[model samples]
Target: MICLNSLGKRIAYLRKRSNLTQRQLMNILDFENLSRYENDERKPNIDIIVKLSKHFKISTDWILTGQEHKSYRNFQHKIELDDNEKNFIKLFDQLTEFEKGQIIGRMEQLIEMH
Candidate 1:
């Protein structure tokens, strides 16, 4: 079984190493309940585990096991992801289809502006 308390520590460590605060992590994690996860009062489910895994570009097993690994590079192809861009991708993937459309529409508007 994964030690959730230790997992919380790893999460804290990675978040800090990435130079983000708990509130900032909440922006990516997007859960009002995330305080409990950071504090080790509650463990996240596998769904959340996979979400965080992809968000950070780490494996779920590594995250649960608290193993050290390379930090995720915020790029794909020629596009480098700023912190806010990364946060958006992480959160956007979790949204409902309607929410996704709204985001896409906003992105289209942003593209049209430039």
Candidate 2:
């Protein structure tokens, strides 16, 4: 069963694991909403849950129920990045925030053009 209190704890755990303050996570959700969520004052809707899942690179099922869906668990073992992709991630990690944002913006624009 999905428990809102447990869900809040999971969200808080993900945020702390990423070393992000509630304010920093504001890019995905407002501080006030995040604070309330973390305090178990309210539950997030499906859209917010999906956003959190993407932001944390985690399964929404894990966030909601602390269990990995069987299909998602199986999919996790199939991830295999090539050398170029691995190098790109390493290089991207070394970039400044502004540079990373610029790169992401350009990538978005390129995707839109396709």
Candidate 3:
């Protein structure tokens, strides 16, 4: 079974390490929502987990299990992005830092609605 307390601690740790307050994390979650997660009063759904993983640049496995899957670690270097993904990255790279953040915030809002 997953340990909610440990997962909460990890989330808090990542936030602090990134120098982000719970309010600053509103790009991914509301302040109260993030506080509840960090307090272990709630468990985020899979969509939220994926968003958090992308925001933190960590694997979902690491977020949930605190460890990388051995197979993933072994084959990660061989993985390749598809052409559409490559094009998306090219476009994203052209944005200013503030515009990039806005894009991420919009994506997070879209994800949260579903």
Candidate 4:
């Protein structure tokens, strides 16, 4: 059950948290529809929802209702997910370019060892 207000807030939060401008969210000529979806003036159709969920690799239920799938959450949260995975990724994405490079270098080392 998607309440329009909550849904809109969720969408806006996710978009901003993901560091995307509304224009970057959809390829449509007019950016108003995506704005409307974030503003609670409109709801995206099921197709749009499916596309977004797949692209984000997020649970549709979480998008609609803010409840994540349990297993993935558990696996990702051993470091203790106070917020959600999206928020964690968002923070990581916002890191400085140099910081990201350093992190990626360390990650590569970890990957090569495994």
Clashes of each: 0, 0, 0, 0
lDDT of each: 0.73, 0.83, 0.81, 0.74
Each model's TM-score? 0.51, 0.57, 0.64, 0.51
lDDT of 1 by residue, 1-114 (tens): 434347777666666768887778778877556668777889988767776777687777677886544443323245777999899888988897578889899989999999
Q: What local lDDT does model 3 show for residue 12?
A: 84
lDDT of 2 by residue, 1-114 (tens): 534448889998899889998888976554358889888889988767877886788888988998888887889789999999999998986786579889999999999999
As for lDDT, the candidate ahead, 2 or 4, is 2
Rank by TM-score (best first): 3, 2, 4, 1
Better of 2 and 3 by lDDT: 2
**Best candidate (score: lDDT):** 2
Model 3: per-residue lDDT, tens digit, 10-109? Answer: 8888888899988888665533488888888899877678668878989999888788899988898887999998899989967865798899999999
Residue ranges of candidate 2 with Cα displaced over 4 Å: 1-5, 28-32, 75-114
Give candidate 2's whole-model lDDT. 0.83
Candidate numbers sorted by lDDT from highest down: 2, 3, 4, 1
Q: What is the C-alpha RMSD of each candidate to the true structure, in Å?
A: 9.1, 6.8, 9.2, 9.9
Question: Model 4: per-residue lDDT, tens digit, 1-114?
Answer: 534347777877777777888888775322358889888789888667765676667778777887877886887667655568768678876686578779889999999999
